[model samples]
Target: MIYDQPKFLPGGDRYMLVEFGNEMNLELNFMGQSLAQAVADNDVKGVIETAPCFASTLIHYEPEDISFKDLQSEMASLIGTLGPSEDIELDSRLFYFPTVYCDPWTKEAVDDYRAKIAEKEPDPEFVARLNGLSDVDQFVRVHSGTEYWVASLGFWPGLPFMMALDPRCMLTAPKYNPPRTWTPQGTVGMGGASTCIYPVATPGGYQMFGRTPVPIWDTQKRFPQFENSICLFQPGDRVKFVPCELDVYELVEAQVADGSYQYNVVEYQKFSVRNYKAWVESLDTSARF
Candidate 1:
């Protein structure tokens, strides 16, 4: 179906999905890339934004500005003219992220992850590099995940999507428990080989072994970045998880609360949602904001 013109979604007028394939395979991912590049490279009229994932591209537009039919035809025509994908070379950034992987924060053991080094504390840099996604053109150096790609941004503002992790470096999921509403801001955590930040202090579900200083999000600013980029990571950018000390968190807390800061509430609320959408969304279900 790589050569086939993209099909229109029968039910929707506002948006349509360009599906690459049914299975999550490598070849399909390439095809998806080709399709995304075609649309991005083409000079369409009404497209406001376009986002690419591992195997699909979500194109957003104002239906009134340009009819969906016309957009589809243009995309189809460009697909044929599109060029081969250049390698996805990500920006290279190496930095340290602060973390507090200790007794109460981290469990003693989780199934096969039975290694104890709780004498003083584990290394602050828990990750050497992360890797799972290798679309080449979007993120080629992500072989070891040392370099990460922003795949999908959602669940909170400024929370960028880091591409998937290597099957080997992945740790088992943490024990099931109720998400905390206020996980200390910049909590560093992992879930099913994926690395994420709580962005701010809010309730969370993933195993939060430590914390970070790099603000995951900031809504405190008068205007939100990327309009509505839920994650600090984006669909094609890379991130370096720098570690910090617990004492540093205390200082940041003070700075955030100070009136002189720019996006105190913005960062907190955005990441608060990122901390646990389940909880916040639940509030909506119960008529609570």
Candidate 2:
């Protein structure tokens, strides 16, 4: 749920955390993103950077330039100037990723967890049952049916926390009780209602079901898309997971190895929240893919 007004709290001396709400919703994120964009556009004097999260925006500032109190005041004033969530327009890029669902890599990881940690159902099967899908195949169909919204990047560099843009495609699962020691890089999974692709091998708790060979993060700057930043995605980007077989995954993996992987992207599209809401209203919310 959205708060009556955003709450302003100081993060030590260098940062301020502005929260739109406690719940994870697109409306709340839009409010935070809109404010973040406003800060950037207006050239807020002391603000160094703004990181918008699922429900809040963390602002880094130079205390020497402006006091925390003054920064809060400035942010509050800027928030007043912004019209509504529907009025927000942001540049969004679409990326198509070839994903192999119910693949061996994540299966091996899940097997290892069951052997060492505790006995539990396999990740894909467990998630499918939990969501009342007929089977893992149906789960994959629903999961890959719609484009996902890139709400924020965090927990790891270039790691996106995304939500289904289509209501029928939403799937939720709980995280691992004793988190896995390591997760394969490019592994795609979900915790709660958010889906994430691990940028690199790291300890994770999301229920893993799919793996993508395409690199979302590259420090070596292998791809042309990584020219601006090491991370391939920005907040508000859209992602479509194209379900594929292991053969296709290996082919793309090989291309990435030699630095010839061409990114499938539609760039520089303006996303209008007003049009998005209208589209959502026209859908059958009770339907499933």
Candidate 3:
């Protein structure tokens, strides 16, 4: 689809950043992703790789094969033919993740850092209050109530930066000021305007709320679901967090241990930005909080 003129900025010597817009928006993300796909399909020489983010595409190219000026001209020409972002269609997948919200693990982690890391209350409760919800139960309900769009994956492999598909489900929270020294793998957290699952235990800034039993990244790739790659989630995929009791979480963990657990995945063709925008606009503001 046709997009506004992109700002092409040089990213050091080997990379170029094509920015569709300064802000984070699905339309802008679509443009970036579509352009990245177009580049791959065309197999343009010297283009080593392309990384699409919320509103920009980072291109890594061989400087010896094509000059910066030449590559820039080629990208500009290719972008000119790309229709509009809204009209672009994406092949997407829907996944179901059984989550235990306010589980003991993340709750303990939040408590451990309450004096130094948290702003007011525990992470989950603080987030609940921030969203104007009455309690943690409502927070869990609202969080799992809508499908989340996988905007991109970063911070760690298979760690998806997700945006709620339904505008009414949108909730915002700031990242930790000092950041946490450690976050458990499978931890579900939210920072800024996106949500993500920690693929591996590591330092993070997102406020932890819940935990999922399933593994999103497996180095061995031994399971049937992990046959394609180590990372389970991808951009354009939709994920629905299903709240589950501790007992259910343990069952899933047992299945995972035996390598018999199959991820719930539904395949579909193309997401329409036009239709999504219409739905977003139709939702009442009160439904958001």
Q: What is the C-alpha lDDT of each candidate?
A: 0.46, 0.92, 0.86
Candidate 1: segments with Cα more than 4 A from true spot: 1-11, 21-43, 65-69, 86-90, 102-146, 164-167, 170-184, 190-193, 201-209, 219-236, 240-289
**Tens digit per residue, CA lDDT, model 2, 117-236:** 989999999999999999988999999999999998989999999999888898889999988999999999999989999999999999999999999999999889999999999888
What local lDDT score does residue 171 receive in model 2, on the 0 to 100 scale? 88
RMSD of each: 14.4, 2.1, 2.6
lDDT by residue for model 3 (217-248), tens: 99999776678889988899999999999999
Model number with the top TM-score:
2
Expressed as tens digits, the lDDT of each residue in 130-235 for candidate 1 is 2222232212122222433344554455554354323222233432243434455665555444456666555555555555544556665423432564344444
Residue pairs in candidate 3 whose N, alpha carbon or C atoms collide under 3 angstroms: 1-83, 1-84, 2-83, 2-84
Residue pairs with colliding backbones in model 2 are: none
Q: 275 in model 1: Cα distance from truth in Å?
A: 35
Candidate number with the higher TM-score (1 or 2) = 2
Candidate 2 backbone clash number: 0
Query: Each model's TM-score?
Result: 0.51, 0.91, 0.89
| lDDT for 246 (candidate 1) | 63
Error of 1 at 127 (Å): 15
| Model 3 spans with C-alpha error above 4 angstroms | 1-3, 114-120, 268-270
lDDT order, best first, reads: 2, 3, 1
